[model samples]
Target: MKLQGKTAIITGAAKGIGAATARLFAFEGARLLLLDKDEANGAAVAASIAERGGKAVFRRCDVGCEADVRAALDTVVDVYGDLDIVVNNAGWQLNKSLLETTAEEFNAVLNTNLTSMFLFTKGAAELFIARKKGGAIVNVCSTFAVVGSPGYAAYHASKGGVASFTRAAAISLMPHNIRVNAVGPGTTDTPGLHDGARDTGDEDQGMKSFLALQPLGRFGKPEEIASVIAFLAGDEAGFVTGALWMADGGYTIV
Candidate 1:
């Protein structure tokens, strides 16, 4: 129960890595606020946690919108009375080359993938500062942030910004006793991947290509990523801050 009594608000908690993290955090004794744009799925996830004797609430929120983000965070604090952790796990991707990517597409990815992090961090940090209690923030970045992908120029750029912002936020929040860090996961098996494949109109081939690039011979599981997130958010990582922990299965090593 590393996070016993802690309150967490996780964006993108409807499915995949976000959902996995929510489950893990509940297991570790944290009260949760699960945020996602998908109301049905997000509510289902929250119900699942509640059925397992965990405390959780679901909110329909589009992290890309500052008003929505602020409202959700405010609601969590109202219900839980305090917010100690935030996981900016909401993201979007466009598998288009630089030449094919339009400004609108780039902005869309940037809004969800990067800007959301900033908005949540700013909102949460203010609360933490006012309470004079430090908090933890874990941004979900990508291995692509460190390495280039063929058709992910905008995605790469957004995640790279997340990495840099994590570091900067860590330093800026240190005085408030807040810790900010990031997790970079490699090709994880998720709904997002399926969507990416569908976008290319060759699901099998896209998946196969992704698998071939993983030296581990397989894609990572969402739970695997969640475990790392739990670690970083807990006291076990008390001394860790401004670090980008890569959970990619040697994708960047080769």
Candidate 2:
């Protein structure tokens, strides 16, 4: 169990990458507090883990809200005793060009996708420093951070910000023994991706277009991406920080 005895909080844990990551972490022996706005699914995730003999709790949260963020940290302390890892995987996507996106849409995307990471990192770092224990943070970014597309302008900007914020947080938190890193997934087949596809006006066409860009000819599995996040969070990656590990099916290389 790579994460045996660790306690973790994973945002967006109701679905997609966050959910996958939570399941994997629990399998690897981490007690979990799963946060998501989707209360039913989040609770189901926690219940499944508990059925498998893992310790897990579900808490509804809007990750971008400061009050919600603070309450989550408090819940971690009260429920799990202490925290060892933070996975900032909550995000919002807009499948629209700059011209098509509204001012409100852009701001909401930024708050959910970028600002949430900052709140968690700062809170986790402070807690880790206070407790005199090292911790790991894994942020979910996207290949769109480095590459560009005609649509998802706001999403691209948010993920690009995630990559930069991760690097800076890593450096700043290094002295306090908190490792901050990110994972960039490319064209993953998640509920979020499907939603983005629908937003493109045609799910079939949007998906085919995404698959065409994948050099591997298939999308990265949620489990595959989750494995990378588990590695970064565990002690096996003790020397790693300030890194953006791209699990993008060779999308960025070409």
Candidate 3:
């Protein structure tokens, strides 16, 4: 019950790590708003939470859209009177190298991975300040933010931006008692990972290639990453801010 009685907003919450985080937060006794472009699954996650006696409301939103983000913030306030934590977990990935990546594709990746995070962090800080209440913001970065690979140039850039931005935002919001932090998850066994494998032009082979590089000899779990996010968003991490907490199963160490 670390987050008991708190209200939260989790982006990209229709599936993968986002969906898992939402569920964990609910179990910790937090009311939340789940945002995702997938209307059906997003609503279903919320419904499932409700069935479990947890307060979760789903909103269909493109995190990259300013209007949609604004509407989402408004919806959270309307549905739950207060906002205590915000997890900017929405993201998209591209497997192309810099030479093969298109300008449009890069922009799209940044909009989803970096720009959306900026919006939610800014909006959430504003709400916290206006209410004179300090809050927590946990951003979802990636191990690729610190490491390099042959492909996924755009994704790497976006995640790197997320990490740096998290630090900069943390400093700016410190005086306001707002804590900003990020989680760098390793390769996880989520639909997104399989999609990335498909982008490699061979799903099975791509997965096998990925597994060959795992320091842990297996893929990470969405729920495991969600636990790291929950720690950052909870009061237990009060003294933590401006940090890139790694849950990468030793990915960066090697």
**Clash totals, every prediction:** 0, 0, 0
TM-score of every model? 0.99, 0.98, 0.99
lDDT of 2 by residue, 110-181 (tens): 999999999999999999999999899999999999998888889999999999999999999999999999
* Local distance difference test scores for all models: 0.94, 0.93, 0.95
Please state every model's RMSD to the true fold in angstroms. 0.7, 0.8, 0.7
Candidate 2: where are CA atoms >4 Å away? none
- lDDT per residue (tens digit) for residues 138-190 in model 3: 99999999988888899999999999999999999999999999999999999
lDDT of 1 by residue, 1-254 (tens): 87899999999999999999999999999999999999999999999999999999999999999999989988987899999999999997898999999999999999999999999999999999998989999999999889986798899999999999999999999999999999999999999988887888899988997888889999999999999999998888999999999999998888
- For model 1, what is the alpha-carbon lDDT of residue 183? 100
Residue runs of model 3 more than 4 Å from their true location after superposition:
none
Q: List the residue pairs that clash in candidate 1.
A: none
The regions of model 1 sitting more than 4 angstroms off are none
